[model samples]
Target: MHSKFKFFLFALTLYFPFTVWSHTPSDSISTEQDITPVLINAYFSQQPILGLTSSAQTINTRFLEAQQTTTLLPAVNTVAGVRMEERSPGSYRLAMRGSLIRSPFGIRNAKIYIDDLPLTDAGGNTYLNLLDPAGIHAIHIIKGPDGSLYGANSGGVINIQPEGFDVSQNQTSLLLSGGSFGLFQEQLSIQRKVDNNYNFSVDQSFTRSDGYRDNTKLHKKTLQTAHRWQYTPKNDLRFFALYSNLGYRTPGGLTRDQMEENPRMSRPAAGPNPSAKAQQAGIYNKTFYGGITHRAQLHPKLSHTVSIFGSNTDFENPFITNYEYRKENNLGLRTYFSYENIDHPQVKWQMQLGFEGQKGWYKIDNYDNEQGVSTDPQAKDNLDNIQHSFFYRAMINLYTRWTIEGSIGLNQSKIAYNHRFPEITNASGRINFGGIWMPRIATSYRVHKRLALRGSVSKGYSPPTIAEVRPSNQTINSELKAETGTNYEIGGRIETANRRLIVDLSMYHYQMDNGIVQQRNDRAEDYYRNAGEIKQQGIETSVWTYVLVPNRQRFIQALNVHSSASYNHYRFGNYEVAEQDFSGNKVTAVPDWVWTNTVLMSFPKQFGLNLSHNFTSAMPLNDENSVFSEKFHLLQAKGTWMWSLKNKRQLQIFAGIDNLLNERYSLGNDINAFGNRFFNPAPTRNYYGGMKIVL
Candidate 1:
């Protein structure tokens, strides 16, 4: 028997009954006393999820509190087509639908927004780690190429909403947690409503950890506030601001032999490469971002919304190779006018027209590293980027059973750079990508009262990010073209009459041309090139149900189960490099199968237990499919007790264990490494205990 098959069978047997979980969340929490029916709402408007023509999901505060609150890694992984990894304490990588091929560290090929403000810059990069998890109240994901509305993305879109944005509640909370590996966290949140038309929220948090590996300590502090005012019956205004200071050590990747010898050791010297410990590899970053939005009702059926935002970042990185410093400034605007006729006797229609634009200025300098200090100058570059998109969308509902939607966007971008140190090409040239059109059409039909079917066709276009054009190798490649693809999808949703059982299924195929790929030179410096083509196809499904309802006579008050799975068959096409053809090989760094499950049980005396398990299959490490990582299973458990105090106060305590199986694995691996230095071992079994006070 094959070892992979045997291991898969063993894992399935170990956690089959305890593995069901759901990503779509209800508006209210489900406790021992309250079992509200699950209601999935749309992000754009007050509509039901089943009526939408696209694949979407939401994770609310209840789902976030189920996992360790220090990071969003576990909670985000529950979505079938999404993957998030934490290489070290503060480093993060995320992908949607196998989009990780172009991302080395941060988030790329996707668009991210905090409410109406853009988190992704004009250069097509997102620093996802800057936002603390405590300030994030909910996450909504559109799980395909949504460029027709968001612009310049092949992966998808993620919108992070702060607390009190969608709710009208006054509350104050404090949370403290301590865990293994010398981890500690403190957070405070305040939400207040002044009168019926004004509300505000403030969130502050601090976190520190001594990681499991050498030179991997981390600490971060963040403060965020939001305000909303309905000054008049026809006008609304909103403001958001954030500040974050973060610092973390970088324990570089290790080879298989080095990992087996000592998993806790930092990257060691090989050939001309210096040891990570000797170089004191680390990163430090400080950033500030703020935005304001206004909306007004122009007529009975017309409305207008506008938002303006700006940000600044000071970033420093001391690596084994060099010391890097960068200062970035960004500003952007988004405005739209919407018209609706939803009260029609037979047909309901709506249309939206919008324009979004952003500009950025960046100064980057590199110098020789002398024990984490900047010394001899190596290179200095100044660059600026401009991006804009005009888009429109229309949707119609016929007879309240059939719906159709269409959207189109035209995007343009330009980049100019100056090589200041070499005094060569000093702002003399610019790269312009002419206007590109992205369009999407989708339809949904209600076959029955409890069933709906949806289909969509869309186009995707993503230009090379700034990092890809001028990577660590410090070379500018102007010939690289943007990657483009067309995606086709079909999906369905089913629900029971009582809403106790719900299921969603989808399948998609995408053919991409001029795909961007990453490579490392002999000196272990990163570069990029274009692959000819790629073929991506996948199937995703999710199920959520309640096995038992709340009962007074039974010890188990309630039991809820949820499960989701993904099967991917991704391959390279027409890919040839240096006389080697990898056209038929499997895609690098993407697993063939991924499954997640979770179970929640409520007991007497306000005690509840939650258990979750994740299984990931082996995946190829390089384009040639020569080597693969090991398959692993992860198990987690948490128990909580709550008490209702006097004066409408509540106290809750939680303790949790992660990696219950203690299996060895790498959550994030360096693909196509120079010397097979790919593995970055994840943490072992750990425990955490925390308490929350709510008033």
Candidate 2:
């Protein structure tokens, strides 16, 4: 660790030799300021940071475009108290101020949105990997539980906005990239505006790679289109459509001994069975989604927005034990109305009412796989899920400095399952999860122009997802229950008068009941069960500083430093299984400390360099807390140069390197595994280079 620190310090010293002795007039700052005004899309309204009472972060796409646009983990990791992990090339899981206990492969316990349309299905699953990074313009993350407005989520909220058409001119771009481990990617995008009222954009991307580990190959293709029309001054319409086909191999986990011996090996074969590699174990998914949103201004103080969305997914998985196929369909509608009295001089208030409804249907079939070929059908099942939620929010500002907001949401959900195998012994079941009410109250006080204080208390509730109740293990869990929790938080933000440094700090405590945890059986199959109460308390902080030396002789145009850290104290309360007292154990996968620091240097002529470092403490691997995963330190760097051509044409060349130290670590690990097989080794030192041409 000391050597690593010294290496980093030496790198910094080489770049900034006279940084400490440099001085510039405070008023002669660069035209491009780092700390600019920020506005947050708070459900129904746009609120400035000074008026916000909750913790939120926004990431601009420029940051993503500067590096490899292959995955979102790097860009999202800049945020405090957030973790995004890619187990393999195309498999990802994320958590925000929570454990990855319930997320085995995909996004769970979080609500995701693309503009005003919901991306999470009724079964509480989000296919975030379906969209390419190049198509996204911005991302907004609301940390902590926000069920009062988002509905039926215990973790957080994420809103993704896609690229929009440029009104000035028609544009086309092509990007090509290749890297180590046979990584290659191609992307094309077109943007055009027909007139003052209509605009459209289309993007397509393809990525393929032979991963660092055996049976970890990946292939993905995505196409997305977005259009907007302003029929009249008071009415507008927007549409989004997407299609994606993805296939990735899963190199199952390995025991510690196996990992140490050969980290690149795939899972070994069981008795009288083929290995994962020989069986071609992997996942194949094809999905299509479309949504339309309409906005109308009814009156001066009233407005309405409505959206309709639908999706279809065909999924197939070839595991060592069996081959599973699923056909899933989902449809949903979201509508909201807002009324505000902003004309008032002394007192201003706003009220919003909204409702969301969704339904999902799934047809699943399992078949025996004999050396990568399906032999005979083993089981068949049909599942249906429905969810409805209504929410109301009211916000008021007193004296233009004190802001208070309150919200309530009522949610209802139900599930039905039909077992179609064993003709004579067919069985069916239905469960209704009644109504759950979630409420929240938040307040913020603007102490001064450069300082603010905020506090919030909210309740979170999440029902069991379809996969949790009926997992791939071919077992139906009829006794699984919902998880509920309460969160209390207080935070503040401060900025220097010169607008060069900004800091944000927050502390939160959450207590949850009926928390769900995943466990593996003797056959390496996954299942879920309630793990009793748990408590999580933590502090999150972020700091940003910008330094500029305006002299023309200096090579550095601007230097920006952004850092974030989190400290967590998570523990289990009343957790016990099979008469064993597992109380007071540390929560699995919840690291004690996580920190990230990024340094960006801007030079002349659109040339820039970025260096980033991340550190994560050791974390428990299971409920027993007897075993733990090793801590890891990662270093990454990227450089980009842009050139301008005649007739509004441009070209950009970029290169990046990851895992500079080539540390041996597991990027993603199976949390609780049978026979203590949990390690999934990540790639060692790798490099990528790419170029983009615009016409």
In candidate 2 the C-alpha lDDT for residue 63 amounts to 62
**What lDDT does the true structure give each of the candidates?**
0.83, 0.84
Evaluated at residue 415, the lDDT of candidate 1 is: 84
Across 156-213, the per-residue lDDT of candidate 2 in tens digits comes to 8888888763335577889999999999999998889888989889999999999999
- TM-score of every model versus the real structure: 0.95, 0.95
Q: After superposition, how far is residue 642 of candidate 2 from its true place, in Å?
A: 1.0
**Pick by lDDT: which candidate is best?**
2
- For candidate 1, give the lDDT of residue 310: 91
Model 1 C-alpha lDDT per residue in residues 576-627, reported as the tens digit of each score = 9999999989988889998888777777777778788888999988888887
Each candidate: RMSD to true structure?
2.9, 3.6
As a TM-score, model 2 comes out at: 0.95
